[model samples]
Target: MDPDRVPRVRDMRVRVLRATTSSRARGPLLCIGTVALIIAVILGAWVRPAPGTTDTPAAKSHALSVAWPSQGQASALVEGLGDSGDLGNKGPQEPVPIASITKVMTAYVILRDHPLRAGQRGPGITIDRTAADESFSGVESSVPVREGQRLSERQVLELMLIPSGNNIARMLARWDAGSQEAFVRKMNRAARDLGMRHTVYTGASGLEETTVSTSSDQLKLARRVMRDATFRSIVAKPSTTVPGVPGTIRNTNTLLGTAGVIGLKTGSSTPAGGALMWAATAPDGNGNDRLILGVVLHQHADTNPRQGSQAALSNSRALIEAVREWLSTITSGTG
Candidate 1:
């Protein structure tokens, strides 16, 4: 074309051609945008998460199991008001000698006849010549009381349960039922009432071989006694002061400060061996109670009392750890 003269009329068609090309390019772009919108809608509708989804895991097979030692004539039991319960026992549930666990019964009877209210010091128990005689170490593990020193009933029960005071056991028996012989009769009757069929309480203290019980029977006694607020309160203390005494009487339970052990009793003798009626409790994350009530009876009976006590404590702690481990695995499992 001839420079400026021929192209004047053709310039408008060039503008139209440019406009057509732009419209043609927009068609593919609109199609691409529509496809992307459809894909996004499909993904939004189909790729959603399932209901109740979370990072937390779930539990499967709530049933729990444990393993324990086969030595000693002992039994370890853990039970609560929940689905979890466990036990580890060696030897038959046959009648075996129960040493100072007998004090649990003595406290039971005294509390049964004369209940100690929560935080109440209770009525005074005078330390007569007979009670004062408990200080004389005829048998091992005796706590002395002055002839005129007066203590509350709760304090006497504390002496009976904490330091394993044999004389206090006798004195409390006499005070409750008028005689140690009579109180023992009540003890047997109460055992029957509480369904401790395997137990017999011949003496106010577990010093006599005639006073015998099975581990299961002691567990039953523990369950019943743990329900009492007064007994529970007295046993939980690590140590307490007598009203007129200068020194504080400490609990003989070596496991008191650990394993969540609150209270119970310890028994040891040449006849009854080393026995411990123990109660353990711990709170879960939600603050629910988990109780492990058990009896380690006649542990290492042939061994000396010191060695037997160590064995009893070791066995009890092992059982507690086993329970905690089993619970951990169950709760942390993925369903």
Candidate 2:
């Protein structure tokens, strides 16, 4: 309790505090220096090559030809077509109505879940009044099926896809899964499964605004469809008759008989404009086969049916040529 003793005690405390602070500061500096040294060692190790390093050989030689005209505008993958064509504007992602190319998906879903063997009968589907009525009198095309008539599931599928028949699509949607709503759910699910990242299905008939696809997405669908022998056969047939329809339904794909053309689908509506998804096969001089799938959307701005068809044909031809040329370059070791 003496005043002199109190001063002495405070002085000792101040000295102890300063020593503690200095030690703490020095500790941090030591830690920082240690970290810096560790980092420097790591950098030195990374920058040095191994003691036995030899010059790496040049990358395996590749044959050079003109680059495929991707132009960063049109994304193209050429496996066999020769070089020398503009694959066209890849452009910004556009949302175009796919029209009946929707059936390509419909067929894909059915084939994946329920494949049909040659000469095999599919499940029988009764023609509901709604299905028949829609098919017989829908705004778009139809394969005439009277109410109460029944057709094999395979027959309905053929009708739906071959002629892009709306009625058969509705009936098959009803028959296969009990309702078009249910079928569309499956369609969308199939799209997801197939990596159709930008696809959405609003209806079984592409007539509905709900049914939509992009050209890129459609080319994906066409690639899948081409793998199925049954689908390929049906789509390739230029004309076929369903028992109930009064007249034979001709294939709507205009390029069916065109050179190097195989089979695909054509779609058009007032809103969807004109759309076509096509596949072509060209010989690669070697034993290899060249396959090209191309999609054109909104080919015509006007609503005239004839004009729309002409636009579709012209656009499709251009796409086919581009694909063919790309394939040629790839096979020739020029692309």
Candidate 3:
């Protein structure tokens, strides 16, 4: 039946009641009947339901079921270029120690303070004895360099991000903001500006175990960093040759090039477990490319760096492939 016609039917009933009423009571009854009809018309207009419909699902039950790693927290964004929002997340959203993934922020802050462009090496930073000496420490990741040797800002960033160099991170922090302590304040401020309320930065290098963030928070950083061409080019390299470093330095993120993963950073320690902030590109089955940004944190917690890092790499690669496969199925109408 037409919903619009229901209001008219009720109006007709009220009029018929008024005609049958006694004259003395007619006036008062007619007022009430008129008010009732107006209310019915208002309600019918307000609750305008579709002409003809039944309760049913709008689309197939193609809900994606991801096999998230049993350990750690993970979040991802898969969408076309310039699109916002993420593909939702798996595991907890609470902040956790993010290991060297902290360096991504270090690089970000440096680039913000001293911007670098493609093919342009920025200012040169002299290696201080402190940074040089820390390179020999067996406890954290570092690359040896002689005191007083100078490297450009671009080269220093390459060292810090590609090799996950803790000392390089400190050096850049000190160079950019006078000291590591001062630089950490900038990091925390940057986090706040980025809307990462759950994140905290206690050190320039994430070695302190106090430097913490969530996978979702790091994903926010991931999107911002990829916008920088310099950061994008540096992190995407699987290996690079740097002056003063023996042989060649390689990226800590072993997942590079796997499942279309292009570039990002990885972090691991006994306290922070293993963490990765990664970016990739894949076809969205709609003739457009989708940029996929993801973060996995606290994989294999309390384990050594090697074990933790391996776990992060393995899990992230699997997650990337799974997302791509799911997108394809949905596009084919078989999800």
Candidate 4:
């Protein structure tokens, strides 16, 4: 049980060799016999170690001293796209409502069913009456699109992701799978395929309180979805002008461009609180890039969506900066 004692075995071996050498004056035969006996005992105790003993160095645990969100679950990973390792976790592992981060899977499934290349428009989707009505109702974040108005598939994704539009998400869901109920099946299936075991997708837009997931589960989905070039391009945008939508719709993820953040998603609601699935890149201190992925959920729950979102954004920014600083300290050994 005491690893400290393991090193003493080598010291004992050195002493035994010295004893054998000094005893050569007695006789070669006796010295050899005595040395063999001592060596056998040492080898039996040290080389053939007991059940729980090990001579190998213990693996060091890399735990970050992050000031995590005051409430809800938070988990982060480093080098997710490469040789990945978990940095740490905070709060419980149980699943809870994820708000609009559900759209990440919605986008993932749509992309898998209909692939898009760089600069490709993919297909045209007509705005439906429900989506149009939701836009004007002021119930949730949305981009205005008239019913029967046609927009490119790429533009729809831009609106859904950047602005965190619930209606746009449903429109895309219905357009792809004929109904939100069926589309949710695809979302859950995609979650299962991606190894998100703690996740459950009950709706395409994540407006349903039943669409619950853990922070760790969302991080897994974050890594997989970020691989798509088109998906990455859409989430990173700060703002975009979509056809059939008024003005320039902006991304709710304000953490973009801070701490080398590139693209990901943000979700919030009265029940889900503020949740964000975020990605960023920084130097690994070895002249190569490292990808950082993280998720924070359930900040300021039961509050208004705007307040929840603000809390999520603020907490996430602090986490990003702290992670970057941790990396810098590791590389420089100055922490």
Q: Which stretches of candidate 3 lie over 4 Å from their true place?
A: 1-62, 81-85, 329-335
The residue-by-residue lDDT of candidate 4 on 30-74, one tens digit each, is: 898888888887777665534432211111244456667878888
Off by over 4 Å in 4: 1-60, 80-84, 329-335
Q: Write the per-residue lDDT of candidate 2 for residues 51-161, one digit (tens) a residue.
A: 322211111112322222221111222333433222323534455666777888888888787888777767777878886667656368887778888777677777887
lDDT of 1: 0.73
Model 1 error, position 279 (Å): 1.0
Task: Output the better candidate (3/4) by lDDT.
Answer: 4
lDDT of 1 by residue, 1-335 (tens): 22343354355445545555655667977656655555555455444433422211111123434334355455555465342353534456778788889989888888888987788879998887887876878756777889988888888888888888888888888888889999999999999999999888889978788899988778888889988999998888888877665588888787886877887788887666678888887654345556777787777786688777777777777766666555444331221
**Segments in model 2 whose C-alpha atoms lie over 4 Å from true places:** 1-89, 329-335
| Candidate 4's TM-score | 0.78
Model 1: clashing residue pairs?
A: none
Model 3 weakest lDDT span, ten residues long: 52-61
Q: Which ten residues in a row have the lowest lDDT in candidate 2?
A: 55-64
Comparing 2 and 3 by TM-score, which wins? 3
Candidate 2's error at 335, in angstroms? 5.8
